[model samples]
Target: MPNRIEYYNFVNGGYFWHHASGETYPLGILVDQGDVLSDRQPHGKPAGTLIIYKDGNVAVKELLSIKSEKNVWFAISGCTILPKINMTAAGFTGVYSDIGRTTLRPVIGYRKKDKKIIIAVRPSSSITRAQITLKNLGCDFGITLDAGGSTALQVKGKKLHNTTRRLNNVITW
Candidate 1:
């Protein structure tokens, strides 16, 4: 869980946060170091995956399109949070219904132009507002890892935000 970030034994200090709100037992796809950790569902339904390659490139792809490539370092699945149909805020809520609700959320994004990854937590924001935030931050694509009580963020062993709800998975450096 994201709250346990401080307990990890990492060589270089980095950030940690909640990754996904999916079921813990396994339903969608999850991969680590080229190993398929879970794939009960085989395909991610209404979900997007954050792929981190061993070479350090990142991409947000649909779950159905993912493969356990040799160079893939890790992959985390979650709901798409930005780039709605036609790139309009009005259509953003159509992708995920829960995102329409205003609440705290943890997000991960990528800026294709500059090859930057954006990770953040937004408080009391709707999907539309969160999309706007991501766009303002220069993100071309993004996904909402978790929301509400599951939202969390930590950096350098210190928590910038903490959640009361226990998390099933988390992303870290």
Candidate 2:
């Protein structure tokens, strides 16, 4: 599949950030051929990061040791709200305690057996609930993506959900 970053200014009917800056930004990092297009430093340590290699391989890094190298094709960062490392759900109860505050939520997970990335955009869910869902989906590792109004997912040419806000960046398969 071809991977490229596409910019959008409006979603669901509102501008991203509620400002008309006319400049599009990625909600997460965008790396192409090891070139870092954009990397949003996590507020603290990222909840998790999904790394896509140039050789068409994918991995979910749960620790804080992420680095940019020549083989990394893409990297998107998100608060590790629910880390299912080692097949155990290690939940986070810090600044992202709004796990019950449901809205549009996006999550990235790794199915160890298939060695594939599982991207899901939930209509309404909290981090805790999302973690459980990921676990049930057999994700050995998972991380919550930038959600709320920024939550969005598109398959083929059809949008899974609609948001009024535009996004700075997007990760595509």
Candidate 3:
């Protein structure tokens, strides 16, 4: 916890620490989320995007519609705290984690509290359940993006080491 910033009481069924500039940042709770736009079978590539609004909100999303061209998929989540990464990248681009085959994979994305980074995990099959868990754990809002190895969390222009590939779409800041 050298670069410790803040703390999230409940994340991925456990508490998580955030680091920034070799020091952890102050943490906050996840506040809001919605799967209204998350399309799994997107006909288009689902980039799995995480957005932090200027108003202080963070969200994970699907870039394209696996279902059809007209229908796009995206999972939006808002939280009491969504930190922004000072540097790096975001998006699941390839097969790094045991996805589709594994049970619960890692959830890589962003936090808004001290603008630090955050990563969470959920089951492989359903992103909804993960959302529910995040909700219960102070992260009242959060959406499931394309999990598995395709999950990536970025900062600035560089991608983090724990980044995942095999994604369909990706939204940037």
Best by lDDT: 1
lDDT per residue for candidate 3 within 23-129, as digits (tens), equals: 32111112123223333321223433444444445454433332322222223321211122111122222442222233454444443445544455545534444
Among all windows of ten consecutive residues in candidate 2, which has the lowest summed lDDT?
9-18
Model 2 TM-score, all chains together: 0.68
Regions of candidate 1 where Cα sits further than 4 Å from its true position: 1-3, 7-23, 40-46, 68-70, 85-96
Per-prediction CA RMSD (Å): 6.3, 6.3, 14.5
What local distance difference test score does each model get?
Answer: 0.61, 0.57, 0.34
Question: Ranking by TM-score, best first?
Answer: 1, 2, 3
- Give stretches of model 3 more than 4 Å off: 1-50, 57-102, 106-118, 123-125, 151-173
Q: State the number of backbone clashes in model 3.
A: 59
- Give residue 73's error in model 3 in angstroms: 20
Q: What are the TM-scores, per candidate, against the unseen true structure?
A: 0.71, 0.68, 0.30
Off by over 4 Å in 2: 1-28, 44-47, 62-70, 81-100
